[model samples]
Target: MLRTLTRFFVYVQTESNLKRLSLCSAARTGSAMTEPKLYRPPAEVRGMTSLDKDAFTQTITVPALRVPTGVLNKIVKSLKKSTIQRPGVPRVVQETEESSDSRLLLLDPNRVATPSSFSEAEAEALRSFGVAEELHRYELKLTYDNLKSEEVLEAVLPPGQDVTSAFSRVGHIAHMNLRDHQLPYKNLIGQVIMDKNPGVTCVVNKLNIIDSTYRNFKMEVLAGEENMVAKVKENGVTYEFDFSRVYWNPRLSTEHQRVVQLVKRGDTVFDVFAGVGPFAVPAARSGASVLANDLNPESHRWLQHNCKLNKVEGKVRTFNLDGRAFIQGPLKQELPGLLRGKASVHVVMNLPALALDFLDAFRGLLHQEPPCDHNLPTVHCYGFSKDDNPDTDVVKRASRSLGLPLEDRCSVHFVRNVAPNKDMLCVRFTLPKEVLFCSDEEHAEEPASKRQKCEDTTDSA
Candidate 1:
């Protein structure tokens, strides 16, 4: 019985495509044809380039009942011999219980049967095969005019099964229109809200069109109050971040703590890429005067706000200007007190990616008579490692240009891995007195006689 069922199913699958076409054509031409109320093609049909014909053959061949060993062998042999040899044709034969025990015999090709005549012939074949049981069967007819457009699918399940539950188990099934647009965004927003990290925040649908144009775009998270607020407790201080108007990372404050530990008391620090006072506030709290600047108007505004929030507005002076332009500007010469002989000025190049490019300007900033006091403008440089080296090579180049001995004067304090196998390093160096005064040609050409006379005078004293 199982062998007979397998043979019947193989015949159905091998001929299904031809059968569908004939059925469709018959329905279209007949007066009794009624449009299917709920039937659609599977979504896979659109993107499907090819399929395994043997898979369908194997799928239909599951045995319905045991058969004699000899009969099974004979049926399997017959199926292998009569198997369709088309490129995508099946290699095995099978049948469902409705058509079990059926055998297919080729008829004379000279006679072509009509649609009704073919149906009658199929019914007769089922009867001759001893498949006498009356069983419920459903023919799922799916069609689509344009493959790219939406598709609908229908399935007939066994009795007592919940249709919705069965469909849900088949996870790949989706509604064409609903899945295309609605589901993806819903999943994204769900992920954002479910994220465990408190530091991570997402702004959703802040930009909305009103009237004739779009304007007044802002940031809004999915959770929290009407205003965005996050409170982080670190280093015995609870810092509140207002992310409504801007976005700020608390990790920067942690980095600032590291920077402060590197600086000694009474140090004047310059924070280049100062975003919302993360570095400046912490440095100022460490008793270092901070000169913080950023190019973004909104960022500078928030930097000022954060300074006031932390009550370090007095120690930190905020500037709204381009860092490189300000460094190269005439302020160095115009304000000798602020620039020249000011050794307490520690230049912080926090932006590691682009900091190496500004080495020349930074070096120029360090150039002054007696060079800003060793206590005033100390240059703290930052750079990241690449694949070629463990330490950033740019720092070596910057040190050489400043006339500082790479090993003796410079100190590499922190090397933190920002990415896999790549590190962010902070290096501090003090400019030599000679290099700062080297621009004075008269000083450079000082005679040995004058130098010896000064030495003799120092010995006499």
Candidate 2:
């Protein structure tokens, strides 16, 4: 069974909209000075007024502070003071930063001391004033510390709160607690689902559960219509999934679209870790012949199904094999003779977080001579920024490992963020002429010092 994990952060503040009411004490029947009678004024006010009983009235101005949208609405409804004049913008009651806790409640002006916990008194106050109903209407923003607190538990509400129903309406849902390592899968899956493109079909898992060997389990659509159901068989075990629980990342689809736009007609595109054909399908649709390969057999099955679903069977070919093995195995023997040295292959490594480990395999595909023909195969290596240094260091390390120059010819394109503090970037370069000519010299030169620096930095982080 797949277990879902979520984290939430909540910040409490005074509401931005505050109701200001003016009330006068009840009149005295007989006394030295009679008190004024209190009366509720109209909802809308024309202008400010002076107190009738006071000889002189003083006006006070207060500074305003921004408050959470959820907290602001509660304040306005609870206070039933008469509106003699239009209410001004709410001023911040207090502006002090506090560490996040499980539950927080702001105090009423009438209260002598603010409550520290969600006590019975606080609950009664909230219930009496109907504040809980208003809170349920808006999603709250939580701080990091609050999200990780033991007392706070995240909850998921189905569309319209269909608590007992299995099938219902489709709407926006939120999934949190995605760790940094799992973000790529989350992002890539999220993109396809949100696109809602008829040409795309995707299955996403909100949970992250890597197998014993550190491989992520494949996602399958369990109980939808024929076209919607995702079928998969792996290691003699079959699993089913639903579309409602899974989320699609909008950013990943945009990136995929960008890559498709870059391709020209009749180009051959290579996707190393082409899980379920996110890259392949788009490339094929753009009129490029796509060679999609993944080590996971389940992924290859989905890739084939996706190709047919998108009506791009003729343009895409799915291969179930390790990326490194595919390059050095059958493809290596067939490429030289099949293309007659005129292959214009464009290799795409979208797995930047782990693409650095495959630099040698990428170098093997590039041409060994100068005036490099565009028809000849070349690599577009992708990787993430080093933790302790700028992302250029990733390019430097990969280039040096492949026995290439650092700055003269190589180009680095920094893509958008795949996760917090991590970016997707591509390094494009051609193999140097010296690659074939100075074999002995290349071997004799010591490995670039930057390679060690990268390993050390990553290890430390």
> Can you write out model 2's per-residue Cα lDDT over 1-461, one digit (the tens) per residue?
11111000100011111111112223323321112211122112112121111211123221121234455555434322310121221222334355222122222222211222234654455566445522111122222222111111111111232111111112132222333433433443233232322333332332433231112323433212224333332222222222232212223545666666677777777787776776787788778888888776666776787788678889987788766666655455444443444435676766554565665553434243233333445567777663444356777767666656657777777555433344457777654434423444344444222211121111101
Highest TM-score, which number?
A: 2
Please, what is the whole-model Cα lDDT of each candidate in the order they appear? 0.42, 0.42
lDDT string for model 1 (309-395, tens) is: 778889887887766665655334433465534335567776555454455553434345454443445667776554344343655
Give candidate 1 misplaced runs (Cα > 4 Å): 1-189, 192-247, 329-344, 364-376, 400-407, 440-461
- Tell me the spans in candidate 2 whose CA falls farther than 4 Å from its real position: 1-175, 178-250, 330-343, 363-374, 431-461
